[model samples]
Target: MIPQTDPKAGYLAQRAEIDAAIQRVLDGGRYILGEEVAAFEREFAAFADARHGIAVASGTDALILALRALDIGPGDCVITVSHTAVATVAAIELTGAQALLLDVDASYGLDPAQLEATLNAWPATAARPKAIIPVHLYGQAADMPAIAAIAEKHGLAILEDGSQAHGARLNGIGIGHWGKLSAYSLYPTKNLGAIGDGGIITTDDAALDARLRELREYGWRERYVSAISGMNSRLDPLQAAILRVKLTRLQVDTDRRRAIAARYDAGLADVKAISLPRTRPGAMPVYHQYVIETENREALRTKLSERGVSTLVHYPVPVHLQPAYLGRVPLGVGGLKRTEAAALRVISLPMFPQLSDAQVDQVIAAVRASV
Candidate 1:
């Protein structure tokens, strides 16, 4: 069966280069926070058009450290959508803050209008609003311009969750352009993934960058001396070396993802039983999952599976409705109508840079027959 995603294929695509980089790291004998990590930080920062990059152990740690660096903790409330990986909300709570969940728009990003209305209606006794994390879900950017405007008006900080949007652009600007700081996950299936777990935070502000660097290494102004309370979340040198090689091919891989998305759009346009992924005007999405919505999602998924085409749900459950967070997480005024609806209908088709035109055509044919 055709797989929904293939991280192993990504490694095989550049096996020689990846193997050589691993050898170099092992030969150096300096594994943790070494030159490999530093070099990747510089290279990735330049790629993201940011002044600095702090490499971390995982994407969740990236978000937690960023919140800590921004001085957001205890009693502070962060606004973000529930239609995202639980990491986004969990990170905020990990930093000793409360997560105020919001809903998503048609593009599956945070709804900016809801944001404005929520801020206007916020009770005086509520926790003081501190930040907004607009997740670039499924490799598409949220409405940053509108979100930025609302954030500025309310004096709130914006920390973009760009884990799935490595090369995405909105109105010709990069994904991280509109936010104070941006965090990206380098998990194996992500657009610019490493061979193993890794994450990075980017920012234009020098002070924020310094604080991030310190926080990732136990708040060390000097070795073994804590300048402040912090945790250990340094990126592994092996993964850093692997990511350095992968980063070089990110744009090319993103272009291939877009090409596959275009193919899917054309092939599936006539299927009235399903809705294709929608792209916002002026946005360049990298199509991490190429999600399609259907009223009878389970039936369609089963049909596709029976035809030898594999599929997966981007998220089967919204974060707020999950066991740990149900009845505890706060929602925006109108509730998570769109977010909950999406959780039920969305299914990810096969998407990865290494997928050939033949595989894509097979998927389309299977979908057409099944749907």
Candidate 2:
């Protein structure tokens, strides 16, 4: 069956180069944060047009480190959507802060309108909302201009969750540049993925950059010195080398993804039962996952699977509704009606750089038939 995502194919596409990169690291006799890691950090930061990049062990750690570096912890609260990978919320809790889950807009991003209302009605007795994390869900940028204005009005810091939007842009500027700092997950299925778990944070603030470097390695200001409390989340050299190789072809791969998304859009345009993904004005998505919405999602998913077209839900449950958070987590005004509806309806079609035109056609035909 055609898989929803194929990280193996991603590795195989660059096997020769990847294998060489691994060998280079092995032969270099250094495995920890070394030249390879440093170079990848620089290259990736430059690609995002940021001044610095802090490589970490995983995408989850990227968010945790970014939050900690910003001095957001106990007695603080962060605002974010509930319709994202749980990692986004988990990272906030990891920083010892309260996560105030919010609803999303049609773009599946933090709704700027909801954000405005939530801030205006925030209780004086509740924890102060210190930061807002606008997740660029499904490779589409959040409504940054609107969110930014609201954030400015409330004196809230903006930390973009750019895990799914590696090369996405809004209004000609990169997604990572919209917030004070942005975290990206380099999970195997991401647009610019690594063989294993990897993540990075990008920022233009030099002082914040220096603090993040220290935080990723036991708060070390110098060798074996703990300048402050931190954690062990350094990016290894082997993964760094592999990521560097993958970074070179990221733009080319992104173009292929967009082309595939366009094909799906055109092919499924007439299927009234399904709604295609939407791209906001002046926002360029990388199509990390070409999500389609339908009321009878499970039946459609089953039909597609029966036809050898595998599919998966980006998220089957909203974070706030999950068992662990069902009654405990707080929500913004009017609750997550959209988030709950999306959980039951959204299905991610086969999406990966290695999916060929013929394979894409097969998916399109299967989806058309299913709908």
How close to the true structure is residue 44 of candidate 1, measured as C-alpha lDDT? 98
- The alpha-carbon RMSD values of the candidates against the true structure, listed in the order shown, are 0.7, 0.8
TM-score, per-candidate, Cα-based: 0.99, 0.99
The sequence of per-residue lDDT tens digits that candidate 1 reaches over residues 1-371 is 99999999999999999999999999999989888999999999999989999999999999999999989999899999999999999999999999999999999999999999999998887666999999999999899989999999998999999999997999999999897899999999999898889899999999999899889998999999999898999999999999999999999999999999999999999999899988889999998889999999999889989988899998999999999999999999899999999899999999999999999999999989887
> How would you encode candidate 2's per-residue C-alpha lDDT over 1-371 as one tens digit per residue?
99999999988989999999999999999989988999999999999999999999999999999999889998799999999999999999989999999999999989999899989998888667999999999999999999999999999999999999998999998998877899999998999898899999999999999999999999999989999998999989999999999999999999999999999998999999998998889999999999999999999999999999999998999999899889888899999999999999999999998898999999999988887
Model 1, residue pairs in steric clash: none
| Model 2 deviation from native, Cα RMSD in Å | 0.8
Q: Mind sharing the TM-score for model 1?
A: 0.99
Candidate 1's clash total is 0
Give the Cα lDDT of each candidate. Answer: 0.94, 0.93
Query: How many residue pairs clash (N, CA or C atoms closer than 3 angstroms) in each of the candidate models, in the order given?
Result: 0, 0
The 10-residue segment with the lowest total lDDT in model 2: 119-128
